[model samples]
Target: MPLLRPRDGSAGDAQIPATSAAEVAEHTCAAEAVFHSGVWSGLDPRERAAALLRLADLMERDADHLAALECADAGKPLRECVENDVPGAIESVRWFAEAVDKLTGQSFPAGPGVLALTEREPYGVVAAILPWNYPLAMAAWKIAPALAVGNSLVLKPADTTPRSVLHVEKLALEAGIPTGVLRVLPGTGAEAGEALARDPRIGALSFTGSTRTGRRILTAAAETNLKRVSLEMGGKSPQIIFADALVYGEDLISQTIESAFLTAGQNCTAGSRILVHTDIAEEFTRRFVAAASALVLGDPEDLDTDIGPVIGGGAATRMLAAVEEARAAGARVLLGGTEVPVVEGGHYVAPTVLDRVPAEARILREELFGPIVTIQTFTDEAEAIALANDTPYGLAASVWSAQIDRAIRVSRAVRAGVVSVNSYSEGDLTSPFGGWGESGFGGVEKSLRAFEQWTREKAIWVSLHG
Candidate 1:
């Protein structure tokens, strides 16, 4: 067991077990056995839904504790963990649980004495490799749907932030989900994650992480069982601010700030690139810089804190280095781009805004995954659309324009999985969330569409004339 500390450098008592590849193999084998036993995978859909609902209740009951663990393990602001992540996770579970009975098969008329039908059945065993940024919430994204569809799941929480999800596994069992049905393996990506990816017993795998790692997982799958893989990877998402949108002023600025820096901008769909119409560029930049500078960066445990440290010292160093590199490449640093020593040993980078960042800058093309945003001016809608779609990644984008025609036009043109018009959002659970280009592959997460990733459709045919 290794002592895991919070990103805020606060003392943490959680002991994270470093699971080995052999352990991962054992767990996958156990999950497969349980999947075959019918204790879970063959149980009534309503029964599985009932157990999941109970699990949701237990999570809500222990919301405070869960939020605390999230704050500690992931260095998320206490307010964010309590108000957003924990609640969002609970809602995800509830939504999926309630949807269990509603997810139906199809019937088709084969004419005469022939019958034809299709049914969605769960893959015997599935694996979900979660990211550290939103441990609890992302876990629910995969876990709830997989369980609802009656699959035994092997969950591999990110090495840095395993506490919250490990706790979730306990609650799942207490809520009547069988022991082997929901197994949590907390370990590094190379060992346990790779083991899960390459194991033939894992019929399906869903991962949310960097693009590079997603490629590795795909390769592993290809070499082994050729298992079904669904990936939601990186993003250099753009937020285009057209002149007409400035009428919303304060509201626009506030929403854009959240889009850019939420979760310290480690979000996969973070709107890191801002493309403003040159007509209103100066005004928008001024307001954006002011609000970004005012964010309260401090210990994640404090309720008043608006920003917390990045995952660790290494993350802080990388973010700051990227900022300096951008400046050296001729970008103007409009606001805080320096490290904030909020506490001894805590990793904090001030909310940073860069103006007139060169198009060729690495910071513009790469996913920095920090509270740093870059701004560029586009003279027209076509240019804005071009700039928005320029990046190799396209998980999410935001189009701000009061003009309906312009908004609709740009939204359609921008290459992204999810686009927000006049505001910033990844949409609610009802909308399917994934990416385009390098940002995603295989399948999307959330809504009814998510169920498709965990299941296989079987078409049955029979003749009544016999």
Candidate 2:
């Protein structure tokens, strides 16, 4: 079959025009230098803010076109693109636009006879590598703040979803971002991604993707220029439900199924592990299976569709292999275990739920990264906490209980970075979002700490004159 190509002459493969590794490296390095030496990093806070606002406006105006391109590239629901992805991306730009002027450096009290102050300076050129899932939103997280702080960026979108990056670049250009300040290089990670990572001209790197790839990038950063690297990687997040939880009956069943199955469970923050009290495990599993079994799987463009295909063929095969391995290891397949019908000829997997998963199973230890959740039971709170933290991942988790104290206690006890009480994976622009352990390091935009990652604090001291 012929590969699908966008009107811009870019596709999953064959996107980059560079014919050699040296050419790719040279182009990426030149773009990074241009951005660092140009107006992007030199603009005043207000000017940078205005540029961001214009970018947001352009994103809003082109929401439909970009969303369609995103859906085509990612196989996600088109409605999700318009309702969630595009709006979220635009809001990120707007938030950072307004936040630039408000973001200020700190001054410390100097000892007698000396004056001291600290100022945040942009980290020169930044390389932002975005994943396929939620491409625009991830890009916005890196782009908005990096630009707002007056740093130029070089972006590389995932191999399967480069069109959205091009679309975003075009929007930024339309929004008056000066040329060479923001450039999109669409190619394989081995080529364009590594080139950007190893380039000495790029001062910092922000990545959102799998842990294996993140580790590789980190190694590259260390071996090459030792640049500042911020990574948001994989997760096998847990959603614990206590006996006294408010979501006991119908709500528990519904929320658990939806949270795990959203985006076909491709979300890094998806509630893949359901920890239920021993007394309620069977009941929870039954309801969860029923709800998940009923989800409508079809064309992503269909407004009524509840689920869509996995991002690509390799992902779908991996998900299916996990399911088969779990079943082979004596786990019960309570819901789906195969693909469903789709309008487009692409990869799709049904929402699946595996019950009685053992600790030793690969599905339990590793991120399934698909619409598959494993249910486990514990007799006590300590056991529940132990079960939740068993995996190497510590990205996000949730605790459900009617008693606020129980929820609070469990929320604090969980090893993940972001934990919710009585809810699942609700992140906003005002809050910080990142991971712990193997999930990766450094939070992205919205968090006050995120700004620090993009900047280097320079302390200035002056001796008092006699």
Candidate 3:
């Protein structure tokens, strides 16, 4: 049996159960039938909203159990999964639930004796392909709004991180969500994910993972139904540092490294690159490296551990090899860049900081999705902006500056989807979360805009003369 393992590298007794093509076909067919029945959508919008709220209530009630499942399954730090992911996901469910009824439509006078009103309706079925890093939270990010707007959903979680989503899907059903209304298929992306993506009955598709996988999903959709697709993919985001923000050297160090190292740097929004002004480069680099090296890496079950392990041995080997390749190319290694053997069974990578990294270094340009960060120096504002925008990704970035005008200008000029000034943020529930370029084709996940992705618009026309 192919078992799902914890960060300690110990596989749980649970096997990687195979889900069949027939099963996927059956699930899609059922989801379509649910949409047509309109049992969910026909409910006064408030009832749909209430269903979501009930799900949120169940989430809170089961918070401790869910948090433990996420920690053991995905190798995430237990504290963060509980403090952030679980609660944050519950809040998202509630937020979209509240906003569902308030999303009004448009009406206009067309021509003589004609009137037109526009309505936004659910797309029937949506496929959400979630990544392993933030399993439970990412699932909530997609399904909360998708369900609130009355669309039936099919969730395909990463093979390595299926337990949490599967656990929650049961909670959702117990909260009165109809069985066909939400289906969780636990299997590999190669089989189940592709099946879901190519299924013509799936009204829309949403994915959060690597750029390579995102491209494959896009191709699959085009070759099949060409269903509406929304992707939140990979990022090699940069954090730009200015001289003025260094007035409190500790503040800059604290915020930037925290963003980079969270989830042991397995986040798509990880600020993997730090572009600093030539003037402040020395001080900023010093403080940043110091904080990174001090991070506690141990068994995630221990709350005192700052970070757990990467997903498994393969991730640790790949992340470390990238660092060695950079070192061989003459980049200066400041800290970390190796694995921590002290943490038993789970894969533990030492948080690494490198400077003078050649532009050609694979670690500098690609998303390592581990606790690795690279530093570079820029001579002026123009150079900083140019270097920051040089990558194919435009997912997220952070800018630190005391000058409000400079901060505002840089924030506007950067090509990223989300930019934070002076602080590091995963972004807010009220705003749209998405990216551009190879980071994604452009789709927002949260807030009012996300409702648009799961639902389609229709025009109602009437002839007053009749």
Candidate 4:
């Protein structure tokens, strides 16, 4: 078992259980038993919804404690965990709890004396493999919908941050969800995640992580049970700014900074690529660098810190190396290109801004997963759209233009799942968040669409006998 260390590299008291492949099998079998037993899945939809609502209430009551656990495990800023992540998790639960009962199948016109109808049924057992970036919130995103729709879940928390999710299991149980309906296994992806993927008992698998890992999970699904697989993968998302949009000035710069550096830039939807119109590129870059440089970086527990450490030292190393690589390839480091030594072994990469990075540079092409943004210039609308759509990823993007027509046109032109005009947003709980290209596959998370991931629809037909 590996001790889970926070981003600061301090001694962490928590350690994830070393659940082996065989143990994973045992857990899956238990989940299968629970699914077939009809204790959870057989409940009335409203009953299940009520239990989920209770669970959400419990989470809200313990929000501060949950936030602390997540902060210690993920090295996220404490304020962010409390103000954003925990609340977001609670909202996901409440949203799904309210929705599962409202989820309805369709009725169709068949014939003069015939009837056709469809009803949705829960998948037998679901497995959700989570990423380390947003532990509590991501877990809730998958767990809430899957459980609310009446499925037994086998959750494999990320190896590096498993405590908060482990705590969630207790809360779920306390909230009247039956034993074995929700099981949390804390282990490495190789042993636990691979087991869940390969388990024939799993009716579906939902994963949020790297594109490479998503591919392997897809392969495992195909080779074994042919289970439904939903993947939300990597991205190199872009933020485009037209000269006219600069009129918003400081407000625009602030939003753009948050887009690039939130979660220390570990977000899959991070706007790491800045495609600014050449007409205002110089001014925008200057203001952007200044704002980014002024962002406060310190201990995750600090209330005033704007940026916390990256996940670990390895991430810090990679971020610094990418900055150097971009510099070597004719890019200028307009701001930070160094590490910030906060705590003794803290992994803090200073906020970095790379200007004029060549299109071919790795920093522009790969997902850095750190506090770094690359700037590039485009002259016309066509070129801007071309630059935004050039990446292999189509996860999320932002289009900024003072003209509503221009913003709408460019927003439609961008090849991403979610696009925001004049701001950065993934939309509220109503939006279906998923990517188009290598960024996602099979299905999406959030909104009513997510229910499809945990359910199977069956059509029924009846003919009147004369």
Candidate 5:
């Protein structure tokens, strides 16, 4: 049977059914025309802000429909879509809309006889590559800033979950964004994604996916036009459970389970690495396994289902292979180690936990990117920090302790971009989101910092004597 296509019908027009090379080329060409014509880039700040607000409103109004589509495409729980992803996307657009007018160029003190000011201008066009998990939310993370700063966007949604992005494009068009301003090419990364990165007309590229893929995009951008690249990539973040923590009781176990299993552990910021004090490692593992084992793996449309499937069959296979490899490397599988059958021919992996994971295992070094977590024991504060920073990723981390000072100290010691104290996976729209090392190069700030990323600074000097 032919693969299912995007609802926009752009696929059929290109003679490349669904997510084909031809569709990607056509979409890239269309986006280049939009940039050259200066439709979105020419809009004034007020007009741009209004258009963004309209898009937010449209997303809010159609939240249910979009959430349903996301559930179908990504296998995320309906509740997650309705309560988290859609709302998060809408809030992102709204935040950027409010920031449009607030984005200002820098002014410098000039000595005698001259006024020096720096003006900011848009990059003209952006290529946004979104991942399969949390497709709508990640797309918004790039789209909101790119559009708010007056740039046209060519979005390439992941092949496994491109339907929600097509919905986003439809909503943008309905929200008064000019034609061709926000075009989507639903194709594989090799064709459409590489094309967008290599296209000279695309002045910048913002991506959210794996670290390996981010490197490829960076190489492509450098080789083609030296376009700017912003990447939010893979993470093997740590959740430290110190012996002094009050929240480390039953509640901690529950919170950790939720964080590890949210979106079936598909989140780039998921606390997949558990660093427990050696004294408490055994108890923590027991409680964690109990909580994770109790989770219901079923249809995502059901509100009561705690854990749903990963994105696609390929994702599921990769996750399972990682588990087997960990087992082979002597990691103890405490709870789940295989796939769970679900209705509608869905792909579901059981919430899995590996205890006594050696530091040298591939599962500990690389991102598992599934509902699986590795538990490692640390003898002291120094050991904890070392274990946390052992992986190539440095996206986010969390520390749990009753003593605020120790928690603060440990949180500061971890080499991650964002650290949560006594909390797991809480991302505020006001804070900057990005990573260090192999995670990514830049951040997505809810404030003016995001707009600065999309703009070029031009120095202007005026003669005061004249």
Candidate 6:
């Protein structure tokens, strides 16, 4: 066993004894045998549903401990972990618990004297490689549905945040998940991640990370058994604000700030590129910058901390490079764009606002996963739609206008997986969440739609006389 150090590259957490490549293969093979044996999959669907509900119950019981571990490991706000992350994780599992039983097969008459029906069955074992942010919630998104559909799972937690998922594995077993049904492999992309992706035994591989790594996972799978692959990749999502909306709307400034800077802008759906109609661009820029400047950047463990450190020093360095690159390209920094004062190893970047960044600027186009936002102006609805849809990446987008018709038209025009109107929400558990374009290929990850990712449909034909 290799030691999996749980550090955010700033300070180190306790070492997690990691499984090696060979061990990962061994575990996946064992999980495959268990899955093929049908010890779990053979159970009634209701029984599978019951097991997940029990796991949800256990998770709720351990919510405080899990939330604390997430904050300590990932440096996300403790308040967010409690209010959003943990609760969201629990709710996701519970929703799948109920959905598994309700999910139905189809039957139809095929012409005369023949009957046709369809059966939905699980892919034997699924391998999920998840990122450090939203560690437990991501686990819930992948783990709950895979299990609900009667597939075994090999979960490889990010190197930076391994503690919570391992604890989750334990909780699953305690809630009566069979042995070998779920394995948590804690190691790097080179080791455990590669082993899981290339293994011929894995039926599907779902990853949530950078687009760069998503390409690697896809190619690696291609070389092997060509396992089913799903990726939820990067985003430079835009928040298009029309002058009509801002002119009459109350609290528009506050709402826009929430969309851009929540989770310190680490969210993939974050509206980092704000497109304002030129008529109200100046006033909106001033209000947006002032509001962004007032955000409190402090220790994540505190309830009052609005913006915490980035995941690590390297992440902060990348963000700083982006800011400098933007400045060098003639983009003006309207608010904080420098590194925050820090002790020996804490990685903090000030919440930055760039004024009317040119369309060609790096800050305007690239996905910088930090508390940095850039504004650009559009003269008309067509220009706003063009600007919002300009990026190669299209994971999420938002259109703001009091006019429902115009908002809907703009939302449709933006080439993204998820588009919100007026409000900025990451959709609920019942909504399907996935992406389009360089955002990578995948079926939805939540709601009834997620069942598509975990199962394949088999059509059956029968003679009526038989």
The residue-by-residue lDDT of candidate 3 on 167-263, one tens digit each, is 8899889888887888998877788889998999998999999999999999999999999999899899999998888875677888898889999
Q: 266, model 3: CA deviation in Å?
A: 0.3
| Runs of candidate 3 exceeding 4 Å displacement | 1-11, 109-111
Candidate with better lDDT, 4 vs 5 = 4
Q: Is candidate 1 or candidate 3 better by lDDT?
A: 1
Full-model lDDT, candidate 4: 0.90
Task: Determine which window of 10 residues in candidate 6 has minimal summed lDDT.
Answer: 4-13
**Candidate 6, residues 306-412: lDDT per residue as tens digits?**
87778877888899898888888888988888888643455888989887566677777778899999888889988888888888898898888989999998888
For model 5, residues 121-223, the per-residue Cα lDDT tens digits are 8888777888888899888877888888888788888876787788889989999998888887777788778777788777778888988888898899889
Candidate 4 lDDT, 241-329, residue by residue in tens: 99899888788999999999998999999999999998898899888998998999988888998898888888888889989988998
lDDT string, candidate 1, 28-133, tens digits: 8889899999998888999999999999999999999999989887888999999999999999999999988888889898898988999999999999999999
- Can you write out model 2's per-residue Cα lDDT over 251-284, one digit (the tens) per residue? 6777777679877788899999999888877777
**Candidate number that wins on TM-score, 1 or 5:** 1
What Cα-based lDDT does every candidate model obtain? Answer: 0.90, 0.81, 0.87, 0.90, 0.81, 0.87
RMSD in order of candidates: 1.3, 2.8, 1.6, 1.3, 3.2, 1.5
RMSD of 5: 3.2
Model 2 residue 270 CA deviation (Å) reads: 0.8
Clashing pairs in 6: none
Off by over 4 Å in 2: 1-20, 36-38, 246-250
Between 3 and 5, whose lDDT is larger? 3
Comparing 2 and 4 by TM-score, which wins?
Answer: 4
lDDT of 2: 0.81
